[model samples]
Target: MIPYQKALAALACAAGLLTGNTAAAAPDAYPQQPVRLIVPYAPGGGTDSMARALARKLSEIWRQKVIVENRPGASESIAASAVARAPADGYTLLFASDSTFQLNPLLYNHLSYDPDKDLVPITRFAASPFALFVNADTPVKTFQDFLSYARQHKGKTFYGSYGVSNSTNLGLSWLSKQFDLDMVHIPFAGQGPAMIALLGGEIQILFGNIIPSSIGFIDQGKVRVLVVSGEQRLPNAPDVPTFRELGHDNLDTGYTLGLAAPAGVDPAIQRQIAEAVKQAVADPELIKYAAETLSIRLFAEPSGQYRDFIADSRRILQQRIEAAGIGKLDQ
Candidate 1:
């Protein structure tokens, strides 16, 4: 077995081959060479760790080398464009978060790659919800308390997110508009930077994924989660209420970690990739890591369902962008 084949279960969102049955493995002849999985985050972060683990599992399943190359910049567009321009021969795949596809399109007016036209959805590797975290020094404790605090501080309150049109950005923006508050927005290249800002007191609030990277801060009380995204509370942070229970259903859940290949790949190859994802996702250790360590839901959601999610999420994200009155970014 590969050295990291038994590494912790991970987060990955996938849209598999044209709605076909679960594939036990990739087609025998497809990956004759090492497959490169591009991750759009800095090393040592939770997303990068998960991607590396996922790559190892793929190496085992495909019986070939799966290389993970980190290209963390421009809010994932740098790596995305690299994959978009790579030959669509099933060797180059992008492992990205929800924002890479849905949010980046809204933020950048001129992008190097067009997500709709240049990428093909393969299969979702993992899925999770977001949470709102406030710096420990902030006097807010509960969701309602945070709302009241925002209203009290008004323009003085500062919040951080990965970038404009990021779910964290949109989530807080939507909340502020509805509650009639004027909070300041601070955008970072990625969550890791925003997280650091939260810890350093440079920012007071950060809405981030409920992943390993952010969870540690919450555990140490460096940050406090006032609200989560799902209908139910989380395992690690059971004290936090979900946005759904607070009557914010739209923000109930999302933050897909999925796979994608450049556009125009053969449908058969897409299926092969999806099959590998399906097989890897079904591994017991991966499933355990997802439910326990990661506090996420793991599944091999296929391409058709994945497309529906993208279409549905795009509309919701568009509405949020317009409502937030955010100006487009020039990439």
Candidate 2:
């Protein structure tokens, strides 16, 4: 029995109140509280250092606390799965290498979290070449020397990796299959243990990063790098040739570090944080720190471009694994 004009007025008032309450409950902001950046490696590694640097810069930009937590194990699956299950509020992030997304899927028969569905790429900040290294006690001094030695030793030789079915181990597996080189794979909990095994003469070869681990050993003449895996040779190890130069084209992909958030995050929020990361990489102080301390170059790729790059990498890895007949891990 109410007039039309009065009913329309009441409906508008109700809509206004609902909008106000919704805005109050959830601010249309990117980051409203402390952000947690999870790293899938032990503290003091290159990825950890980069994550900390990014955390500091992001905190300054957002004026909010940013925490870096390490959950290293299971070939980075532990930390990655934890982040994947986190709320999609843009507060929890994962800083990991290409291996976490690219290789882990092909390695493990079943994964706790789906890399493609549970996590989305945010951006990539840095990349560096990995090297084929041997302990100083080992008889090999060059790639040729190591290849000859591996062929001669056959199944008796041992190789250590940062983790099972990781990029480091997969590289060895691909090489072993291609050249008919038989070397046992010894997977460690982390890089520290693998480095110790290499240095202690428990393992003869290691496919590892250039920073924090091999640099000190190479400087002290405790480890010999036979080939560097990248497009070009490293400045510090200019004498070392790339895997491509050595006629192994498939091993040319290097290590990459990037940030990812749980899937279903607000697209606007993802862009906001991704821009913050791009700006952070351009900071002069962070550049100096990465070059001097990490012995790696700093680079940045936006979320869209990084996603494409990772897709290409994943395709290549899958093809290589299948071609090599590397079966999936039961665990």
Candidate 3:
């Protein structure tokens, strides 16, 4: 029999060769099977619409089934956690928003998965600017006018946000703190309900996305947009002023939707998914759909850059949540 040391050395050499062969045999052909794109919201919302639009475009590009599954609940926590637990094979992805990877972690006391540790950013698909609107009959015509009226009304100035810890709520809280106003916040199930409450005179102001479904109301003189929260004016509402121009430079909160996969996915597969996403967003049909339906600007940043962006956004949102003193949920 060979000596123990010689036998161990021989075993190590064989193991190394096997490892090299396995690495060389790894397939780079991504999406060999159907890809599941998870949208952490209800089926009819903006997030779902965008996810379906992306899935269609990706299907055309890959010539494979790109399925969109809606898992809506717990402020998008359910869907996010599902994706985090999915296999790290790049076949499953999450179409996430600020609520999932940013706000939920800061606002909840317990989470099934840590976004920073469980998910890897792939790309940012679009950014939807928040619009502050009032009923068309309201005397407030501009941001300045609204501020003046809010001050005079004292606690009577009511603003409707989607929920307590949603982007709309956080943004409205920041604006209220900055302007030294005591506006009462009314939370609704979603932006649709919040806008409905505003239209029915149950609330005076609402912060929401500018979807095409609501454009008719604006054109019909039912809702008047006072200002939009963004660094630049929106193309759909060019005349609307930005919060920065109104002297609230720090009130630039908008919704950014992106794709993320469970961490430890093969880097090559991640790159393939990111490239597919970029190509899908660039397609003329997809661009037209985004422009006409969502009024969202196509802002696609690559996976590496998107990781940095998510990190920065998480920090900013955490600071806001703490400053606003939003109560934590018990998970």
- For model 2, name the residue pairs that clash: none
lDDT of 2 by residue, 1-331 (tens): 8799999988987886877644333435657789999888777556677788889988998889999998988888888999999999889999878777888888889988889999998998888777788988878988889889999999978998768767788788888888888789998766667888899989999887666656888899999989988788876677889988988887665578889989998787888888888888889998887765665678779888888988898898889889778888865
Badly placed stretches (over 4 Å) of model 1 are: 1-27, 250-253
Candidate numbers, best TM-score first, in rank order: 2, 1, 3
Order by lDDT, highest first: 2, 3, 1
TM-score of each: 0.85, 0.87, 0.82
> Alpha carbon lDDT of residue 178, candidate 2?
80
* Candidate 1 per-residue lDDT over residues 1-331, each given as its tens digit: 5345333322111333343322533444788799999988777555776788788899999899999998877778888999999997889999967777788887788888899999988887787777788998888888888889888998988888766656677888877887877889898766788889889988888877666877788778888888888757877778778887888785554577889999988788898889989999899998777766666677888888888888888888888778768778886
CA RMSD of all predictions:
10.7, 4.4, 5.3
lDDT of 3 by residue, 33-147 (tens): 8999988765655667888989988998888899999776666777888999999988899988887777877888888778889988888879888888887778988888888
Question: Model 2 segments beyond 4 Å from truth?
Answer: 1-28
State candidate 3's TM-score.
Answer: 0.82
Worst 10 residues of 1 by lDDT: 6-15
